[model samples]
Target chain A: MAVHHKILGVATLLYLLVFFIHVLYFSLKKERVLAVAWMIIYATICVHTLGIVLRWIESYRMGVGHVPLANFYESLIFFAWSVTFILVVMRKKISYPVITMCASLASLFLMGYASISPSVEKNIQPLIPALQSNWLHVHVVTCFIAYAAFVISFICGSLYFVEWKGVIPPKAVLEDINYRSVIVGFYMLSAGILTGAVWAHYAWGSYWSWDPKETWSLITWIIYALFLHARMVRGWREKRIALISIIGFISVVFTYFGVNFILSGLHSYAT
Target chain B: MTLCTLRRLLSFVKEKKTIRLPDEDRLSRMDFHSYVPGKGLGETVGILTKHYRLAVNGEQGAVLERGKLSRYGVFIIHTSIIVILAGSFTGLLFGYRGFVTLKVGETKDRLTLRGKTAAEIPLGFALTCKDFRVNFYPTGEPKDYVSTVEIIENGKVVLGKEIRVNDPLSYKGIRFYQSNYGSAPVFFFNVGGEKIILTEREVFRKNDLLMMVARFEGKVHDFGPGVLVAYLDNGEPKAAWFLKSVDRLREQKLQGVKVSLVDIQEQPYTGLEVSRDPGVFIVWAGFALMLLGLYVNFFLQHRRIYLLRVSEGLLVAGMASRNREDFKKEFEKLTEEINGRTS
Candidate 1:
């Protein structure tokens, strides 16, 4: 198997273990072991990154000569890598082990899709004429980074909601952390769209084409826009805004992977 | 004697009716009516009615406004829509998109059209592909396609550049792009009663009255390509309309001219897209403004912290903002830093 495949397998197994441990910890109320679980998640993420870089090198050997973001398998791996990377960054300010589970779960889902999904082919392919550009690296990496950040905020937002409505128990610290994560995510998302627009204009003749990918991206941006408006203009409570953030992140997921797999248009290259 | 005869001939040719008359008056009046105000007003009104509006206001007064009316959240949405429309229109009206496919030595006069139809035509000058090359991966997937092209005007090459997918060539308000690739049939021509057997190495001029002959090169022994002939007659040109496979010549006669399609060659060519946009700078500026707006909206949270001195050393501080938790945390951190610095 390829290095990427090995890393993916490892990441998947680790993520599943982490998920099981999270459930067991939550049920058994073993909060102290949560830190150890987070460390395990972080280590798996590092391994995933190493695997991606190695895969990139492997593509160069195969003469593809582009980043590992050309197709569904590579993109899924990238998505997992980005989500984990962002989660690690947020951990410093958040100081909570619970959110690590979200990253682990997302990684697990990506690995599962890569492993079992017949539609997703795990082989290095050639770059199309349209994708044969240096912008491929800059455009794709930045967008996924921003997406990862959004995923983090979304996870935190779910926690905020559960706590806010007394469904899980209100924790002010957790809610505040979730709100901050969303703010960071929104900023990165804005940057990602801008970068993508610039890349589109450079690659294609137009900046925005109302293609399904572009439309859904705008839709994702709009959801976040509404989240911002609710936070700033409407003076929304953190709990409600967090719930909206979760909803917004779900839309982001749909926009990133769902748009590629389910919907077809200019972004079909991603699929 | 020569002068007198010349003067007589000039005088006879000069007539008042031929110089100016009733017909000229009517034609001038028609031109004037075409430019009259009433005719254009209806068109202007039609355009005015198509404009949309967006507005936003609190109970007291308007906060944001644009277009026809004001509504909350309309500012961002409408601006975004306008931005999108403006970008799209700029792309459609001024944006040029076409592809150029050239074999190893073959050159093309025009790029192939892509995207919307109306946006594909070249606004000014013609682009000719001088060269095209494709680098392939070991697994048979294409790595890159590069096209070398020149902008020609009045039979002279004005500019020359090589363009790739990300790195497009732009000169004098036009851009050339390396877009796609495919295998095109190369043909040989025989003209002027001489067998001019040219392979993939010869370059042919457009609308030239030249006979052609083509053949298959590789050992694949497959059915080959066809030959096309374009001829110029009395300052007007006509193209031969027929497709002949390899080893098969189609003979046709047009306007008493004998034409035959010889052979066809299959050669790989690169496709290039061309475009020209005058409003691209404005669109880029709009993107910058949008990014600025988002940055300000996200990073800069409006918070005011006021401090009032009580008696002696006691002081009370208050904050008026929506993000009370963030404000409180920042306030505490600031006060701690200040105390540490003062102490």
Candidate 2:
């Protein structure tokens, strides 16, 4: 087995452990277990970061030197990494245990699917000429960061609709997180779309091809824009905004996965 | 689609009417920014004012430029959307995308437009394909495709360039991109002391005999480049491989006829996508503006702090257009500093 795979497998196991510990913390309300879970999360993130870096180095060793942001497996790994990394960074700000639990669970889902799915290709592949541009770095990074933010927002928004049993943050805090994450996500998604357009212009000689991926990204952007306008300008609160947030995240998932698998376009290499 | 979005944004901004400052009571005195002596004191202060400056009515302190220019961020974003739409509109009206295929040592002066209207258009100057090359990785994946081309204007070579996937050759606002390539192999053969030339999938015919090139293979059993030839022997179809190596070609007999493979020339054709969009720079400019606008809109806010001279000491009140929670914390910190300095 690959060194990176082994390290990432350890990280994945630790993530599962973190989820169980979070569930325990919710029921028992023990600070010690929560602290242990946070420490484990920190350690898992470090190991996860190492695994990603090692995969990049292994690609270079294979003589096909390129960043790990080139295929489905790498993308899934990076997506999970971005979610956990962001959650850790924002852990102090969003101190609610449920938020952490949900965010970690989301990352775990991505990591699990990436590792166990037969459809996902784990081998490092050579970069195609179209993907050989430097814009790919900015495009994929910004897009994934935006997706991670939306994931956080989706968790908060879904929590807003649920009746919590114990130790959950107030509805106001949940709504605030939903709003703030959408703002961060909106900016990053805009940057991602613009960078993608620039790269496409260089490679295909057309900035806007109305390809399925491009069209779906635009649709996702419009949905988020609607969410922002309704929240900020229209002074929308609680249920409506939360629903928009959930729907916006659905659009995001469709853009990222559905477009790649169900439809064909310039971004077919991602599949 | 862009136009419709622009319309919606314009109406949204217009419907909001203008920027509003929060009304707070318990502050008696006002400053030079359009203060009215009524229930709504300081209502017009900083209202519809594009410039921001410190105004002291009874006391003077410090003046800070708290990103007042950021208020224009919305304007900048709206105009950027318009500029982007206009740029794309210009491209739609004037720009054209076409494709031209040129074999090595071939020149063409026309291109066929690629779209619903598939029409031929003149290139104004002839483009000649001098050479074509492709490189592959050890895994047999294509690394790059390059096409060497020269521009011929009035029978004179003006410019020569090598075009690749991301690197295009441009002249007179028109660009040529290396889009694709294909093998166009030429083979020379001698049959019964007569020389004949053939290419892949070409048929050579003589009296009562016919031969056709079936396919060209880069390798056959680790031997070098070879060709598969199909011929008719008394109306019976038979196929055989012809190797480039002289020893391997010498052993091959074509249905009782002594045919020898003389030479093989592998000439590939380069597929070039030609395009000219005059509004590309405008579109880039719009992108820059959009990024700047978004940064300002997300990071900066319009804030106001009013210090009124009362009978006791001073009354301080603040207002912010966005992120009220953060602005409130900042307002508290600033007020604390003022109290510390004054007392």
Per-model lDDT: 0.61, 0.81
Identify the runs in model 1 with alpha carbons over 4 angstroms from their true place.
A61-65, A92-97, A156-178, A238-243, B1-123, B153-155, B183-258, B265-270, B303-310, B314-323, B337-343
Each prediction's TM-score versus the true structure: 0.71, 0.80
What i-RMS does every model get?
Answer: 2.2, 0.9
What's the chain B TM-score of candidate 2? 0.62
| CAPRI tier for the interface of model 1 | acceptable
lDDT of 1 by residue, B140-226 (tens): 766667777777787788888777777777777666666677775565444433344354434443343433322333333344334
The CAPRI quality class of candidate 2 comes to medium
Q: What does candidate 2 score in Cα RMSD to the true structure?
A: 7.7
lDDT score at residue B247, model 1, on the 0-100 scale: 35
> Each predicted complex: what DockQ?
0.37, 0.49
Instruction: Give the local distance difference test score of model 1.
Output: 0.61
User: In candidate 2, which residue ranges exceed 4 Å CA deviation?
Assistant: B1-65, B184-266
